[model samples]
Target: METGDLVRELRTARGWSQGRLAAEVNAACGTALTREYVSGWERGKVRPGPFYLRALAGVFDVPQAALDAGRAPGRAGGAAAATTAALAPSVTSDLLGLGFAARLRGGPSADDWEARLDAYGTDYMSSPAADLQRRVAEDLVVVQQQLDAPAMWSAAARLMTVYATTFPRQESARSIQWFRTAAEAADRSGDVGVRVWVRGRGALALGYGGTATGLADLLADQALALTDRPSVGLLHATLGKAYAAALRGDRPAALHLADRARRIFDAAYDPSARLSDYSIPAWRMNGFLSLLSARLGDEKQSAKAREAALCELPERLPRFVTHLELHKGLTLVRAGDREGGLACARAALDALPQERWCGTLQMLMAEIAA
Candidate 1:
């Protein structure tokens, strides 16, 4: 077995294309290797140098000597096959790469791409999920086409994070796919914060979507373990677990988890800082509280949390405002005003654009009706 053969096998075993392999290598070693370079190495047109060999070893999680020996990392050739079977769910099957054609010319500068991603983040806060989904997908095609450098992965990760959030209610399967890709892209960006943030957000999405509370708990626990210091990741993950507990009818556990999340928010979150796509802002934290408390039948706490959330929520984010309103209606129902409460909840839902209704909102609406 040649080194090139081993490299190709490792890449294919992980279901990665030449471009994804290049991204992984670059991310691992801070190198500027491109897909063409990956092609050359895999085809035996050129061998990877010593430095690249080390980088490739890390990317493949194999011993460097395995490449030198031109053999699979473990158990002759069986380990690679075993790894493929074991990690297939995390590994993407998109061999051609995100449905984007590679660009012939250099695309936007790194700073320019960062700015564009930030703008997309802003749009995400204000736009309807269905409307924003199409635009973000289009932008991602452009970003994927120009993903030749490490910095581009950060942009791709951020864009995919926002894109995944748009898919929760309407498209669960697609949501899972994009969330997995977003986490992969975040890992490739070599940013620990981004990696934690993606997982934390995905956990919350799973919980709020009422789809997989067990998976949500797993993702939240993983996010909590990722960092030693307090962070928005920890806060969001705690909140996600709290919501999952509430959904499971574990009232005491849910309240305890919510308390833990509040402490993290108080210690780690800056009250004066602006809202961010990556971090949990004060309003968002309160919004989580509002929904959690409402679901738990804590009318007083739910009303307080709803008031706090509405006070800080930006005018542009009408969806969040509507969420808080739904919480108010839930509180009203929990307080014995069923007729008024149901009407309020239904009216709030009706007032919001049909395209903006998400899984979280729908879940709340169903609870109010019940």
Candidate 2:
């Protein structure tokens, strides 16, 4: 196949329009290439430059060689075949089986949806935010139609988590709205555990928004009330309350709640568990505790928590690494290492996609600069 045919095949396989593909390429390559440029390449009207070819390879997760190899006489499509082979299994699965027609036919199974959500949650730190956003948009539509289905509540809750984590600063209102919708879906499903989990997540999002500390406390308390025994969900909700207390200058209450959260986390944490009620791991709890400690003026305790979080860092979850780094940055600032703290903040920002540029992080950067 021609290079143009190869480009069209790959783009179509991913279900991305020319414009969307161009946006992704720009984000990945830090370029200003346009949809018209992409269209020209696809139409064989213009050949892509070396930089553009590299950008396409990065966007497609393929090697430059795969993009350069033209079709061989007997082999049908050399570059396209090589590109497909180089793609990740998940991407290949989408290319082969997932499309608009498949979506119109009612979408993938709940297990498949859960698997994709797991992948998104695990890879949030390093994956392109554009890809995550596109997946969420596609899944949200199918999930909305399946509100009455058994898996809908969990699916909605996962989307809420993604939006809250990935777009916290830029889309705060939308994130809260998604969390509320997830909570309502959980309620409609009559799943108390799901409700508690969703509410706990919402409480964190509320705390992150700065002005909703009181509502954060209320939502967390409500979630705790729904639980009889100690759980990861309750632990997360308790941490949310601690954050709220710290935000409001109630250091005593914040420290007390933080201690309680640590105890609950100790009792409820399971390293081998596939999923937690709140979708937060114990190490992440340590990161949050470090932030709370920093806010409460306990630099020693903050350092201790940061060390623990670093020790428990998971391999695949770069987001947790970013979170831990952010906490460390704040802790360093509290310890008077302003320049070092700013460097750490910049590293955290560097790990994220440009489109997911966080408001909170920008605020931290400004504070350090000031």
Candidate 3:
């Protein structure tokens, strides 16, 4: 097989687009290779350099020799030959280890589904979107099949939350659809906690996507009503409502909800609780508060929230770090530091994966530009 054929086959097998494959290659090798470059290589118009070849090997989990042999006209037949010699061992091992045949016949275990959900959250911002979407689709199948199992509802809820957060702008309808499915599954399984959590996430998605702020408020209010007492979920849902109010230019309502959310978070938040994708940490809520205060033109409160966010920065994920920076940048802009804010916003955007450039970030960038 030719190298181009091999690259194309491996990428297609994993359900990756050319751009996504290029992104994965760049992430693996710490080099910037563009979609056009990948397209050229796959079209046989250009050959991959050593760096790209090695990166492709890592991305596809194959040997360098296999890629090299694929490029050699007389070395082997094409991807078929390379697959037989280079891919068989790993493929067979994965099939056996994952119980591929059995899973197809009997569905995945709840534990397996939970593990995949956790993995999705752990790598939410870093992984290639095409790969992540494929995994989510596969996991959703298993989750749907196991909806009667209470534990699976938790997994399903997490999956929906991650899906909504990761693809808020690009897949708005699909995200909402899955969120509804997650809520229904949780309710059917009698998991009110998961149901409320999913509703809160759905509200955030709606607000962030600028789809319907009223619906966002309704969902958040519904979630708040479902919680009996103070809880992290209630805090998140209140914050979601606050965020919706902020986006809608309702300053008084936004500030009131922000204060309410903070009070609940202070009372109910347990540091030792296992953090899921849906769980909003104190630092993240602070960041959101900063954005809300900035939007409400309360420079003093915005600065205070910014300080709190910065103090808690070290505990955040890279994704949240960038998010916090964006919030801080917006606060700075609201304080009349346009140049400084633009620079900080640009830096945060550059630090994240391209697939993670959602509507909220885009709106912040527009504000900075203005």
Q: What's the distance in Å from true for residue 65, model 2?
A: 42
TM-score of 3: 0.63
Residues 266-312 of candidate 2: C-alpha lDDT, one tens digit per residue? 78777776533235576677777777887776878888988888887
lDDT of 3 at 355: 67
Q: Per-model C-alpha lDDT, please?
A: 0.74, 0.66, 0.67
TM-score of 2: 0.63
lDDT of residue 239 for candidate 2? 79
Task: Indicate the residue-level lDDT of 245 in model 1.
Answer: 92
Best by TM-score: 1
- What is the C-alpha lDDT profile of model 3 across 1-370, one tens digit per residue? 7889878887877778999997765433335679998889889999987756765764564556767778532232333344345436965465344445444576667778767766675566355555676566555545655555678677777676665554434334334445555566667657677777777777766654444456567778888888757766677678778877887788888878877887887888777745554455666677777777777778788778778877876554566666667777777777889889889889998988876566556656665676
lDDT of candidate 1 over 1-370, digit per residue (tens): 9999889988887788999998765543334789998999889999987767766764665656677778875444544443344444533233123443436554577898778777765676667777777677666766888777778887888788778777534334345546657777877888777778777887787676555566578768878887856787777778888888988899999989987887887789876655656557877888888888887889889888888878878787888888888888988898899999998888888999888787668867876787
lDDT of 3 at 212: 44
Candidate closest to the true structure, highest lDDT: 1
lDDT of 3 at 87: 39
